[model samples]
Target: MTSTSSTFIAGLEVGHFTDPRRPTGCTVVLARQGAVAGVDVRGAAPGTRETDLLAPTNLVERVHGIVLAGGSAWGLEAATGAVRWLEEQGVGMPVGPARLPIVPAAVLFDLLVGDSAIRPDAEAGYRACQAASPATPAEGNVGAGAGAVVGKIFGIARAMKGGIGCASVTVDGVTVAALVACNALGDVIDHDTALPIAGARTLDGLRLLDSRRALLAGEAPRPLIAGTNTTIGVICTDAVVTKIQATRLAQMGHDGLARSINPVHTMSDGDTLFALGTGAAGKAPGMMTLGAMAAEATARAVVRAVRAAHGIDVAGLKLPSLAELGRA
Candidate 1:
């Protein structure tokens, strides 16, 4: 596939951490006009804000901004920063003589990645919002994805690095894109091996365990087998959709997770997907086409997160990548 450079978003900016699993705060501007949006939570362990708007039944209502941050529940505080910044910039709904930016936000667990005490705060959020201005948003371990990881089923000792990933597809002139920060109890498979792209391997790069057998015999460990975990992201499209429709689409988007992960949305995982309408609605991509794009893009995003990450080795425990594992 040919890599497309990028088109910038005016009201959104992202900041990330160098260390994998650290906090990366972000800010999204509602801009002058409110955008249509929806939310979907499919994880067994979820912590979020403005989730009520995801009801799908009322997505048509305009939303000023969406924030995804790292800090577990604490990360959600970044939205306050965004709210304050947007308000200062007059980006939200007008109330009496003042404008109120309705910024909705989400949080993913990264306490396991960085300094649990170090989380995205309202101040960081404001910086992101203040800096955002029609620029290309950063990706890959940036923003809320700084401390994300995948395939922690074996435990943090072997948890692979995680980060933010993005992919976009075009359908009938309309385009839909997905950006995900995958830190789940599940595994993202290589398109070919059917095994985890982030799996531990032998000296020959062979999988150390029989995940297929584990799945069949039910000895296979899951997040419940491991602990609560989650994967979250956003799906954006040019297609015009009601909030509820987009919410349902976000739910349907979980199908991608089902296809790509081993044990998804487990009690320990807080997998979520938000859907937003750019309103550019380049053309009508139709529901099915856009949905398929979202799923495929999600899978790609998962791979990107793991592949872009660097291995972590601390104390006596060392987590290697597929490359280092090949030489084991």
Candidate 2:
């Protein structure tokens, strides 16, 4: 599939603050007026914050920001910085004299890919907030995708680089977009062609090894693998939708992940998705249509993440990019 070239949604600003030193970073999606939001965590090992508040029964109807970061659980602190930034800007749920900024966040494990000691913190979140903008944000190796790696079925020794990607589509004047940081323990596949784009490489580094095929062949790796992978993302739409509908949208977003990644949502991966509805354009599409768009956009974004990624050497391990494989 071709890379997403012109995908955008109104009423949202995206930004990133990366620390290449640790090879970890944070990404913030801000809505100054707040947006109705919902989340769906499908992976068995998710690391998140404030997800309970996004439940349909929760009293909070809107959220000010969403944070995606590296550094495993420690990266949740980035959400605090995002909340502080929003509060300083006078945004959030108004109660008495204070506005409690609601920022839901998710983290991916990149510790083994880079400097495990340093992770994204409140300061990183704050910097991402300051860098927020409406223009298309840079993809691959920026923000939460900085240290992302994929296809660890055989272990880190055979893994390839992964990163952030985005895609959007306008249906009947309503825009739906998806931003994804691909850090899965699976191979990325081109949904349309059913071909592997990025994943574990053979020992010769001349061919892609399909993780699913290997697993199905009864090739089981060590048993100590835990919390070593995840893929996180956000789906944004200009359609007016309720919290339940938003939740449904987030659930549908996983269809994209399923289509593009082999062996997804594994026990060791924390795959989480968030949906945000701005309702700023005054025209809302049908729920089915919106959900389909969300899935397609998400799939495209996942492919883009692999396509835009650049190879990197972390510690003594070397990870290759799809481009380096002459597949881009």
Task: Give each model a TM-score.
Answer: 0.85, 0.96
For residues 11-39, what per-residue lDDT tens digits would candidate 1 score against the true structure?
Answer: 23333323233344443434446667778
Candidate 2 structure quality by residue, lDDT tens digits, 127-183: 999999988879999999999998887888788899999998777677889999999
For TM-score, the strongest prediction is 2
The alpha-carbon lDDT assigned to residue 92 of candidate 2 equals 88
> How many clashing residue pairs appear in each of the predictions shown?
18, 0
**Full-model lDDT, candidate 2:** 0.90
RMSD, model 2, all Cα superposed? 2.0
Q: Quote model 1's TM-score.
A: 0.85
